[model samples]
Target chain A: MSDGLSILLSDVDVGPRRHPFLRVDHLQAAAGECVGIIGPNGAGKTTLLKLCCGLIRPNRGTVLLDDRPVGGWRGWRGWQGRRIGYIPQQTEYNSHLPFSLRDVVAMGRNALKPALRPLDGADFEAVDHWIAEMGLHDRRHQTFRSLSGGQQQKALIARAMVAAPRLVVLDEPAANLDTRSRWQLRDIMERLFRDRAMTVLLVSHDVEFLPGACERLLLLRRGRIETDGPRDEVLASPSAADVLAEI
Target chain B: MMDAYFIPILIAGAFAGLSIGLLSVFIVGMRMPFIGSCISHAAMVGAVYASLFQVNPTLGALVLSILAAAGVAFIHPHRRHFDANTGQAILLAFMMGLVFLAVALEEGSRTEMLGLLWGSILFADWGTVVVTGGLAVLLVAFVIAFEKELKAVLFSRSLAAVTSAATEPVYLAFLCFCGLILAVNLKAVGGLLIFSLLVCPAAAAYQVCRGYRSVLLAATGFGAMATTLGFLGSYVFNLPTGACTVIVGTLIFGACSLVRRALAISE
Candidate 1:
């Protein structure tokens, strides 16, 4: 009911077959809220994240972003800029592709600007800031596939954040990262939420990787949200231990 | 050192080489080198049908190639029954079958039919030169104009779709461009040899280049070099022009691979 809600999903069903693969009756995220989505494998966490970002539409339901329907927002050019940011579970980059760390990060700015236009000074500055923030300045010129797993994750994070989006959706971003990188990722998410009031939807099977700023928790089970409430309440619930065990 | 006849041949070869070389980077980069093969065979089917109907082979080739490319695009990547690559393969086989049928049905001189199959770059006319040159220029201009969009799609199509709304249109346009280039150059390179020209140069460049722009430049340079050298070799050895060109391209790719191996060992 809040006018400041960043995302709203109502009666959503996704996937083929007589029985939908994933269904969400109702879900809402207010502006500046960091919602951690934790679920076991096959619980449709990634699908829920994709639905939020309009990468996959629901078979039946209305999804809204900032008071506008996602279908309409999808029509706008550079919709990711200042609106939605998504870092998929897999980066989907080809090893043969000659994209460098800087090039990957620059794509964020290019997504905002018109095609064929070169990056201006402000764009470069923003890119530099994110690269430095992600501690990737040393490897900025290296081919993306040449970097370590942690470095690649950081670069993808920088790419997702470079546009200063209103909502950031990350699907299992820390899955392949090491312990140090996972902690660093949590720190980055916390900083972004604290300093910029950036709304975040972090999907992960690992609960420890969730940022400290994540106040809301949604536990997905078999394509449905079995528990949705404040992080502490969800954690203290009787089924929380079972969910942790399932993961 | 070029003679009057050799000059037109070289020019046509260069135009087709440059255009195909540049586009090949995308084909190879996207890991869909078979797309070139698919579109070229579709063009071949078009040319055969045109010959049977007494129509413009170039127009027929373009139309059929576009339809084939679009068909590949229409197949969903997540289809349970048929994937995009499988769909392309089916289309290619169907087109190739139709081409042979059309050739068999024709009662005229088989020389023309063989020309479509094997190509005759040595006998290229002013018309071939003009069409190839115009298409080369158009392809170059398109790459320049949509460089970012193309890069985005090349990097990742689904990611590009999420970032920019122009991904689908740009992707379809890219496929259409592939069809156009294949159709226009069908006579010079022949359907059978065009795939090698479209992939070998780019694959060779990819072996050495560390950046995307460098790969594009190197691929185009390698394609032109191979085509010219192959033409000279064909002229001196009295061999098929298309076969000679493809052989040169394969040699370049093999040499580049060896160089890459040597560099990797030294490092």
Candidate 2:
């Protein structure tokens, strides 16, 4: 409702046959807020994330980013890539690709730069900083597919944050991570939210991986929001308990 | 010893090999190797139709192959409803049938038509050499100019789009490049065998290399080597040039696989 919200989805409908696979009447995330969206399988969580990232357009209604309609922005991809970092689900990665972890992370900067130009000193510095921040300095030169699941996740997170975007969107970031890696990811998310004041929209199936910095919770079921409120209140609600039970 | 006549043939063969080899890295990386075969067959249909109509077969092949690429690109937007491989397969069968019909309907010497099916690189003219060489240069420039975007798309189109690269246009351009390369190489490698040249060298390089840049360099080297050796073998044994080239490429891939296995065991 507020004009200053970072992301706003209003009366959105998406999917085949106009079937309304994801119908969110209204959702708003203010700047620097961390929101966690949790739901069971086939609940449109990933689709919502894709829509937010401009990877998919809503079949109907409007998605506004930084108070601007996403569909109206000329060269929106350039805008989105520079300002809105997106970490897609691990399943979206192709293991057969020949990119090393450093190469993968460097793509964050490459996305913003012109196609023909090589990475400059600033780009290299940013890539190195994130690689070290993610504790992947030792594995930076290794092929991405050769890394363990947790290591790969860390690399992906580093890639998403390397550009230092104002907003970051992650889809199931902790899906296959080990407990220690999940905790590390939690710390990273907290640091991004608290230190940098980066707005984050995180989608997850497991509530256990939700970072402590998440101030808002959204529970989706069968393409509709089942609960949306303050994180602690939603977690204490019976509806949230039922949703987690079904998962 | 290579003579004046063999000079044009060798140059054409090498250039065609390099162009197709560079494009093959993208085709193989995107996991659409079958689409290459389909595009070559579409070129065959165009070549045969041109022979029947008395038009320039190379130009005709370029048009048809581009059309086929466009068809594939068009069908991609509806990928959930229609699989791209299925569309390519359909296009391949349709083109094969059309090629046969065109050949059957032709009143002139069908040797030319047959030549398109099984290339005669040894008989290549200087013009063919020049065109193929030009294409080879253009392809290298293209790779250099769009290396980052190409790598992102090859890794994953969806992820590439999310990262803000315009994947659809890049994908369509890639498909068009594949078609154009197939069309130009029709004289040197033949429609039936060009796809093997496109796939084998890149596949061999993929087995041996861990980085994309290395893969591109290794595939180009393998391709040029296979093509030159195949041309020499064809001259020595009086074998089909196109078939010999494909055989050599496949053998290289096999050798690379063996080397990879040996290295893995040693590690």
Candidate 3:
């Protein structure tokens, strides 16, 4: 309903047992903010993003998106929870089902439809518009798996946008892409921010992966946030460069 | 083909093939071919148990397979202690062991048991025709009604749910329908070869088809043609219908493979 999502994480602790311990005593991102999350490999950045996306539950505390519970009680992601568009790491999808890029992008409307309803002309129009927006119209008929990694990543971004999400979260979108493709993605990322006043959360090891719109940075290490401030201020932290290099 | 007695069987074969052909796409796409094997064995276990109680084995087969399918569909893969394939293999072996035990303990005639385990299309009655036709219609209708949602879950159920697609109930219902369809056909197609019908045609379609709709249409067409030919095989050669159906399906796969190879060479 709002132009963007306002996120709040309060006293959140996840998987203190079988997995690495992740705790966020307090964190908040206002509407339309571009926040970059960078941390070491074991820093629980993915876990934190998963929490924000309602993919996992916190053991100790709650995540609130726009003042509503991140994921509803008893593991139901309510309307508020559904407004967040999440593109997980590429490796997370275990199976490739040979869907065309067009069909795959159309899946963004899936979360918005009722149970028995098929996507309509309007949905396809949105899909086509985003496909053209992402410059993937020529290859819309190609199987998603047949594309290059950057192309697939672009398709995923298009997939996230079709839902008209208030918050868009991507985890390592440019991880395995070539230098040229990564730079291309950076342009798209900047364009995405410039076109919409929506919240964006990007998790990447490469600081340069963050778009120029990224105004704030959170440096995480060993499941803890060491620096949470403006991009320049966090980058200016004495330990930020060393930690970023190690991860 | 127009004979009064043979009409029901011909209708049953076409409808059954149509439904099974559609399900094969999901099974193949999920990369869980083992689930089919497990369901067939589960149906066998149910059949043997029904024989133990002097009841019609079809009833038991339907109930047991549906129950087993629920476990496979409803439980999240990550929640399990082991891999999905491993769990299915374990379930299949356990069902096989149970089938043997039930067979050993029972003193009833083996005729009904054999009929269920090795289905004969010639014995298909109007009742079977109705059940099979109903399942086929339901599967087709479900696919149409839930096209977008079904595509999402097929792509990846978790991703669909995370994106806020109401995939859980739809996915569970899809699996329920698939289980029911497979069980209903078990009496006419045999427990062993039922899985072939559910996988072979769809897999063959993948060799040339570019999209989901194409595969669905092609698989169903292949299935209908194979079933018709198989019926003729029974009439002409007096061989087992299931074996004939499997032979035709294998031929289809082989031809498709050749087509793929030829296309590759040309390219």
Superposed model 3: Cα runs more than 4 Å off = A11-25, A58-60, A72-77, A93-98, A222-227, A238-242, B1-4, B78-82, B265-267
TM-score of each: 0.92, 0.91, 0.89
Off by over 4 Å in 1: A1-5, A71-82, B74-83, B107-110, B265-267
Model 1 residue pairs with clashes: none
Candidate 1 lDDT by residue in tens digits, B1-267: 657878888888988888899999999887777788899999999988998899988888999999877876656442233555677777778888988898889998878877888887866778878988898888888888887788877777656666666666778888899999999889888998898998999999988887778988999988888888888899889998899999999999999999989888220
On TM-score, the stronger of 1 and 3 is: 1
State the number of backbone clashes in model 3. 2
> Which runs in model 2 stand beyond 4 Å of their true positions?
A1-5, A69-82, B74-79, B104-109, B166-168, B265-267
Interface RMSD of each: 2.6, 2.6, 2.5
In order of listing, the candidates' clash counts read 0, 0, 2
Candidate with better TM-score, 2 vs 3: 2
Residues A1-247, model 3: lDDT tens digits: 3488889999898875555468899999999898999999989888888888776677778798877776645346456334667787875663355679999999898767777667889999999999999899999988987888999888988999998888999899999899999999999999998778899999999898788899899999989888899999999999898787888
lDDT of candidate 2 over A1-247, digit per residue (tens):
3212288899898787467778999998887788999999989898888777776677788887777766434536436434667787765667777788888888777566865786788998899899998888998888988888888888878877886777788898888778888888888787767777778899988887888888899999999999999998999999998999889
User: What is the per-residue lDDT of model 1 for residues A20-82, given as tens digits with 9 covering 90 to 100?
Assistant: 768999998888788999999999998888777666677888887775666544435325444
Among these predicted structures, which one has the highest lDDT? 2
Predicted complexes: DockQ each: 0.42, 0.47, 0.48
Interface RMSD of 3: 2.5
Q: Give model 2's DockQ, 2 decimals.
A: 0.47
